[model samples]
Target: MAFRAYGEVQQRTAGPKEIELSLFRQITEALEAVAAVETPPLEAWADALYRNQQLWTIVATDLVNPDNTLPEETKRNLVSLSQFVRQCSNRVLAGNDGIADLIDINKSIIAGLSGIPVSTVTEEAA
Candidate 1:
């Protein structure tokens, strides 16, 4: 009985959208941490950036599924954005750019997912 209760709790916590939003938040927080340090650990920054890329890859894959309920244009846009994320992540990792842009993108998506007005979300990092 205890195991079954735990399973139910896990299910509640791991709903697809919830999981995505959680990951986005995690990535955002990680990036913020890296940015705060004088000399951030490359491994930690790489790990967080890679996780964000992986999340977008999953989103792109799901968007391409026939059973996906989103409108065609929406799916297309999301897939395009995912591609951009992949490219941008590589550039950021290569020291060609900062992670601020990536953090902004994730925060925007999180605001959308949370059904909150983007304007109301504080622009503060993390």
Candidate 2:
């Protein structure tokens, strides 16, 4: 009975939205850590960027899955955004742009998932 209850708790904690939000938070923290250092070690930056890329890849894959319920247009938009993230991540790894935009993108997605208006959240963040 105790084990079953624990499993139920785990299921509740690992719902789709919770999982996505957690991933976003992790990416945000990793990006912030990289940004906090004037010259972050290549390994640390690479690890964080790779994780972010992996998360987006998974999101893209899920968006295209037949089981996914998102509208066709929404899936296309998300897939496009994921591709952009992949491109930007490569540039960031190559020392081109900063990670602020990537962080902002993840934050915006999280806000959308949480049912918060993006404009309001952006204003508050600013």
Candidate 3:
């Protein structure tokens, strides 16, 4: 059974890996789109970053199935991403820092999800 331990969710429901992978793909695609576009609008980029946070949080919360085993790193990313997204919301959106930050966070998130290392995602960023 999925249970919250020490304020961190822990459990990997059936097919959670698949859902995580799909979410990662979405993030990657968004980054690619932002990269390919010629000077994508600040609003568009900021919006993309915000949406990226939405996607990551949904996955962390288990979009496809119950996910109980979210690592400490995942939890931290989830929180940070949420905050960054919230900060980006309804703003003038005049630069690409938001987008760049989102991209970096996404890469680190995927690395953590891939079992590379959880703390690696949050170390430098935080």
Candidate 4:
């Protein structure tokens, strides 16, 4: 989810509002991608690779852009990513984490959200 939110950000705007929106979208996408079921033979891995690459590109650019709407927010996201890069250490088939890092990214997103409170209790608690 974060990736999509980040992608929607339009740094070219007057106040970098567009870029902020993109960042928000990327955030949401990255967050949601976590729970999505991986259906083999359905190009799921490829899709994930494509999306992650896109997200990384935007994030990298934003990190260096002086016009970044929310510099602190961007940094926080990068820190989250950095943590994932370290925490996701493991073996892989073709230079990738295979499906392991997906879990890490999801966990990272949750960690990123740690400051936010979850106001509602779901059925599991009942």
Best by lDDT: 2
Q: Model 1's lDDT to the true fold?
A: 0.83
lDDT of 3: 0.59
Q: How big is the positional error of residue 119 in model 4, measured in Å on the Cα after superposition?
A: 13
lDDT of all the models against the reference?
0.83, 0.87, 0.59, 0.48
Displacement of residue 12 (Cα, Å) in model 4 is 15
TM-score winner between 2 and 3, please give it.
2
Worst 10 residues of 3 by lDDT: 5-14
Model 2, residue 47: C-alpha shift (Å)? 1.3
Off by over 4 Å in 2: 1-12, 123-125
Ranking by lDDT: 2, 1, 3, 4
RMSD of 4: 7.6
Q: Which pairs of residues clash in candidate 3, taking residues 3 or more apart in a chain or in different chains? A: 10-68, 10-69, 11-68, 11-69
Predicted candidate 1 versus true structure: per-residue lDDT over 1-126, tens digit per residue: 999998689768788888778778878888788877878887988888888888889999999999999999999988998888888888987889887777777878889999997766545542
Q: How many residue pairs clash in each candidate?
A: 0, 0, 4, 28
User: Tens-digit lDDT track for model 4 on 1-120?
Assistant: 987765456343436444444444454354345435554433544554445555555666667677766668767778567445443432332544555454445344443444333232
lDDT of 4 at 59: 62
Tens-place lDDT per residue, model 3, 24-45, is 7576667658766878776766
